[model samples]
Target: MNKKGISMILGIIFTISLAGGVKGIKVKAETNNFTVDLSNQYRNVTHVASGSLYGLSDENKPSDDLLMPTKPNVFTQMAPNGGQLPNGEASPTGDALKVAEKAERSGAKINIRFPDMYKDFPYKWISLDDWNSKIDSIVDSTLASKAANIYAYELWNEPNWTWNAKTSGISFNEVWKKTYDRVKAKDSKTKILGPSISLYDEPWLKNFLTYCKENNCLPDIMCWHELGDAKGVIDVQYIEEHVKDYRNLEKSLGINNRQICIDEYGVTTEEAVPGSMIRYFSEFERAGVESACSAFWFRPGRLSNIITEDGNPNGGWWLYKWYGDMSGKMAMTTPVSQTSLNLDGMASVDSSKKTASVLFGGADGDNNILVKGFNSNKFFNNKVHVKVEEAPWYGVDTKLSQAKEVFEGNFNVVDGKINVPVTGMNKSFGYRMTITNKEGYINRYEAEEAVVNHANKFSNEGASNGQYIGQIDYKDSYVEFNVTAKDAGPYNMKIGYANGNSQVSSQKLYVNGDMQADVNYDSTAGWMSSGKSGTKDVQIKLKKGDNKIRFSNSQNGYAELDYIQLSKVAKTFKVRQEAENALINNATVNLSSYGSNDAFVGMINFGDSYVQYNMNVPEGGKYKLEVGYANGESSASTQNLSINGGENKVITFEKTGGWMASVPNMGYRKILNLSVDLKKGDNTIKFSKGNTGYVEQDYIEVTK
Candidate 1:
């Protein structure tokens, strides 16, 4: 609320238990097993849902989606007049009591700021006696009200800024120690968080930590600001790196691991965009941050306001809603590779609900959601059900009456593999995928079996999920699957392969004695690291009878064929950016962003050179080619983009700035939309400079 544009709120809620009260709550047993095991050594203490509120009015009718336990007041106008209140209400803590009361009713955690009503920052600098009196009075008032949600008291915010500390010529370190001592001497139970530096400045943080250690008055939770996207896009990677630096500094300072609260994380881009906040949520969950709040300067119509003036919901509001509704312990999931290009997402599994919920988006096309990590030992009773609902920001002003389900179906998970196709995915909209259990879903093959060349043996040692064919290095080596389909329709086929080699390996897929598709196996971590291959999806039509599918490398043996998985799901011919025959000229590649192990072409600074991908088109028609990229400069860049060597179209690259200057401003916008016509088989698409700026290229997906 103050000039720092940050606040904390904590109060008794009628429904949800406050943070301090929830330590006694027991969690329900889970039915679905997760990939990220959280059994031992991991604690779900970081309340990623925690946020700051604007005022008591905002608290009167809190959104079920917003999960803020502890909130602080933003404005100093709420301070008491004359170091005292109007009778029986206690002294020097004016409307904060009222604000705290409303906050408690709404079930929030409160972090009350010591009142600062001076003309300027910190408001005023008074004598030691005056400061002590004010602190004692406010503490007494909150204690009288029995506000258990008042977990911590924050000292002056953004003290590192010169204006906030321009009082009585006293150093910020001295003021913090003096105030901390006063609060502790009165009520040692109330924790203190202070010198709330505005930014993650190394020199300032180090100095503050040193001062706290020397004074023997360290905060229970360390707090700082993450409003770094001043000139460019908010770089999620840069923020994560900065957090790690803080932890390292703490360890070097001989301080135990203290909780961190990013009290002021300002949203620079469109709050409604899926790429806007999902990446931050992922980083916070991974690092186990205690709390965070988006900085809101004005009350009613700020771009970052989750709730608008008329009490309607914004697109960003629904993201928090999905997050708030999610239950159970945070489950482990395989890192989504597309997130590197701004396809952002966070997944949680509630075994009790029989739901594996994922909040995903930031692409301009239909994205693929792959499920893995299930084993034979872990079993589910029924069919796997998946539903995707879109959360568009344009006119979604009111609370969601009911989420409009765009796609819903029941599918079988055989051999612990399944693909949940996400349609209507875009950067401007968000989608919540709920995968649960249903009764009638049936699988023809619980465990698929494949026949390999007698020369190559089936080895369990190098398999990722189950037994895979290995030791095949000669030409004409092949593996075949004898699969049966109950119905004549298109099915999604996933091939599990492992190529630990540094070079690209090729295989021709033959169905019923006819050439079907060319499978490319890229380098993985190792032979045993089956996850490195990822899941390659191909569309294959099967007759309502027995069929034979064979994968062979006629030229040279490539990778270890792991398994063949088939499901009665929709089909699409998808090609990744890292697919084979890529001609790189001026661009370089690396694993730069979130969940990306394969390299993406980056730093396209020159104009003459280009990188081209030889695409293997399944069926050529008018198809949408979605390009994934990020460019965070203030102005948009342009590229000479073409498909199948068609007429060159000017591709406008939008600015996707980042937090760090050294890092490229490649903000994640999962997909860039383009339309092109192609012939049935091989076609080449190239990216070259177009008399303008540079852009980072992730990959392109072509679909009808």
Candidate 2:
């Protein structure tokens, strides 16, 4: 749990991205008389759309609940993009990404909500198996897409709700450890903050990190969401007092050194619900509060989007090209002014008073953010030397840039500001701020792009796992691989996709087989250029051979392949099943009767894929089970599924193809088995998708 334990990659470089930051010069407030222009804090929008509302997908279609892996405890409503209709649910599409783009453009930082998927996404944790693969895929997609200004990845939303209250608290330790491992495996930069919880509830923070450290998952920053008192009035708003307590919670949890970011902190009028939540946020911020937006439409879905006006935000504030601003607390003109401040790098200034505010926006944790803009305002040439006498298992790198050129080994500052301002840059895409501090560490933005952008999928023309031998048409979208002799000799590997201009002067290839060519977003390259779906082709070279060949990230879409041949993979099959020791203890006033549907039923959660065990049923009735996937077979037609039953009232599930597909519209089905009246015994069920049915069975319950 030591935040400083990991090292950073030194002298790294990143292209400008994310576009603009903070907007609308809200007045600064000196909290507790702490005089610092933290205007950026209030520079946030309110009411981020839930996972159900984000507007993306082919059309504005809300997710399909009937296909839910399991019946949701609460009936979900189709959240709207203001007045806009629904979007897809589950993942982010270009449209959803656009929503985030639009929000950030209008000046909002959106939140990605957990929708009610009938399939029960997180229910996998209850299962005996691990959900590392699914978690990795989600994190991978988030990293690859650069979809939102991801501050914290909150655990399943409102997990403390009524339906989940009785359930044992999620083993946050396990979640953190696994999430850490997954992010580290691919990225070793940025900050992986999280476990965004419902409250600091007593020892919640302490318990969280204790579990994390004990289990090898320490968060860089602890995040929290406080659903403040619903009926509180504006001026008498005690939410501010409550928020301050969050900092106290951090200290109590021994996480004093770790920074705390409010993932969701706002006011509420009527019982603190979602809709009222938005109005609450607006009033609260206007009351001079520092907060971040929960965000709207940061994923691909048709339902939630903050901006109702064709994706443009409508409320408190909206994001525009990543560079959006929120109104700060300072009473306007009380000292509101912007001027060309000097030397100190002041962001804004009051020329009459000659006082300015400076903004030091760096990812580095040195906390060197100076309060006031240099005298009036300006960027000071600074030098930072990070000494790593002792190091961690992996190395960390840092990239420093200021417009004109990427600074590697030396500081590239001439005058105060960036050599070149990013004016006229594509506003749709945040070209990023004029300056940057790329701290290369375990948690990073999109480190994969740092390594060459690869295909989102691995396309092999061979039957085995490590087979790669190809000579086919290569579009900028596919990859090919082959096993060659280790014999020392030059091997010519012509790429299938060509720009055709043959501007072949300074082409370079590193020892790693990563071909270096001028990247063309318009031409065939990787995602930066070619827009392919999942399953495309890419080429890899081998010196002499015996090694497995496959592609990396498939988020850029598909990849095609000519062929692959290194070796054959051994295939093995394991029969999966879901079982129980007793039946749902009947409502016949017999509390002593212990059966599958009793204590054993709701306790079992299935994740990834599973097989079954002992089934002993007494009386069988109608049983309904649901399952879902993390990511795969996103289409209805390819939703391959299976269900097996055992004991008393055995009923086989009728496969309907798309029953176990992706989010919102998840794969679902109902089973009719009158025999399972376990007034005494047990029963079992098993399922899967992909080559395996990616089904998520929340919990098997029985009624009177």
Candidate 3:
């Protein structure tokens, strides 16, 4: 048979498997193709503008760095001195303003929901005079603050269910007009956003807009909510249709067009999943909506759901960060299915930066991204550097290190296009494809090519080389790869492996006969599953010329190895300081049977207790400070970190789910990474008990 015939048969088989809902079936069909037209730039990169309703519960809950990376365009919060949700805590307008300076510093805005000032979830309305007074007070305070980013005053939130016109002795339209007039009377310049309904109801919106237009109280920005029903199922594909309907409504009424903002969107189930959230982003961007906010379903202060409870970036956060990183102008992208929850993507071309980025994912199968009109731009020659990465969804609580680079190399532009194939996609994972004009290096060594000792080579449909080394269950079983480096001081070693065990597995790593860190592999669904392969990265020192890298079972490790990749580390200066070496106050350094150096600092529950480390760095500007700590509490813990005697920065440490006494053997030890700015020379970094819980310190690693 011809190659094309064989391919067609395989494609048919894969399609049948998909129809049967078979798990772990790898598909190679190129039917899910998305085209990116680089020459057609639509709008600036504002798709990341989506924020959350009541996303910020406190002023300092989610640190500034965590919130800044998402580039929130607008956040909806409750009225001042009002947080009476029956279930979870919600950010009030008063405390929300405290973060407005930093949250809105980068052209982001905050929308205030006034009805929440009544201190009831359903909102118990008082007399009309009392409501007017409350509105006046909030308006006066907002005007007095001089906060430029207080974008709009939302008259009410979700009035479809929360408001009662008959009981209040006034119609909702009358109430809206009265509130709108009162707010504009106090602050004429501040924009007013209105009729913030629960969902996109055509009748409700038409009536509200008609009344507002007739009363000469038309909102400066049109606002509504797009949330799932009681079942927590939301179809984001309808966002474009709803926006178009609103535009047509404006034209039919002969009213001036208004900026649209879905102040509250998404549901609990879709908040943290990258694949689900990317569709919302794509739809919102394609519809040219001015701004939007994710609906806060679970915990507040989590930036909708991008952040975990312990203040770590979840898989969804990285996807939004990638969207935030995009600059210049967004290019036109045509997905395979625009109206279905299938393969879709958003692309952007930054000519000034000489880069193009595409973020895509929505289905679990093979896909292709066709980049066209690359030759139309003068920034590209015949060849361009491309790097493809996957941000895997590792549950909400599991702290992920970073996005793994699945493919990286230089690709020649054929004619005026480049077809980038992506395979074995997990529906919950989001993929990022970057094209740059600069050349880079990424060396991948397949495990099957390595010298295997007591290990068997097996085939995997999803593996890069179509084969992997497995059965490394004995202590002596190992795989060693001989690699060459150009000039390496330190390089990032990414181990591609599959561990289907119930718990995390580990493999001892060796570089040139010297033992390195124990690489941890999180559990997957099953062995050789198409979308279940995972990667773990560790920093290792390599010689300039040749190096022998080995991975062996520490003590019956049960992870199958796929491949290992070596890339030049962006941060050169990495320093590890043991907690035992720090100047401990009110804390005891106990000898531990686990972790590095076998000693840790404990008894950090006192208010004045601290462990200070004085160290010098080689020309430091910005560095990542990784705190190794263990908190076995049922809930998350917190600690205060002060650098160079500066104001303390609160660090939330997630519950390790176990302790040294409970699990032992490095199972409870976890690293919390924080970005800090340091001087070129000496600095004193201290961890103290300021609004903190009991935590044991292992060691701190600083890298830049």
TM-score of each: 0.54, 0.31, 0.63
Candidate number that wins on lDDT, 2 or 3:
3
Residue 52's lDDT within candidate 3 is 75
Which candidate leads the pack in TM-score?
A: 3
> How many residue pairs collide in each prediction?
28, 140, 2
lDDT of 3 by residue, 409-459 (tens): 555576677765565676668889999877666466778879999989886
- Model 2 lDDT tens row, 1-704: 00111122222212211111101111111101011342333332322222222333433332232112111111112111111232333332423233444444333344433222113433423431234444454456556778555444433444333224235354445545655776667655535556656554545656766677666667665555554423322222333454466556656656545654444443221111112233323333433333333322123332222222233222111111111221112211111111111111112333333222222110111111113222223323231111111000000000111122111111122222111111111101111112222222211011111222323422221111112222212233233232333443333221212121112111122323443322111111221122110111112334544322323322222222212112111122111122222222211111000111111122112233333433333244443333211122243212222323432222233343332211222223222222223222434443222232232222233332
On lDDT, the candidate that comes out on top is 3
Off by over 4 Å in 2: 1-130, 142-152, 161-170, 213-216, 230-236, 265-291, 295-704
Model 3 bad stretches (over 4 Å): 1-30, 85-94, 229-232, 443-704
Model 1 TM-score on a 0 to 1 scale? 0.54
Order the candidates by TM-score, highest first — what do you get?
3, 1, 2
Instruction: Report the C-alpha lDDT of model 1 over 1-704, residue by residue, as the tens digit.
Output: 00111111211111122221111111111111112222222334233634552333323444433324222222121332333232122333324555555555545556665644343433556766777777777777767877666647777667766434455666778878888888788788977765567677888889988999998989988887765543435555456667789899998999998877776664433333434566666666666777665553333122234555455665666776676666666654433442253565667666556666677665544345655544432444335666667765432132444455454545455456555544324455667877777643222221124576733544332242234566555565677777777788877665555565654455777878988655655444345333333334556777887888887764533566655556664456666554112687876764332211123566666866677877766576887887766565578888887777777778897775531112212224345788888888678888887677777666676776
The 10-residue segment with the lowest total lDDT in model 3: 1-10
Q: What lDDT score is found at residue 209 in candidate 1?
A: 87
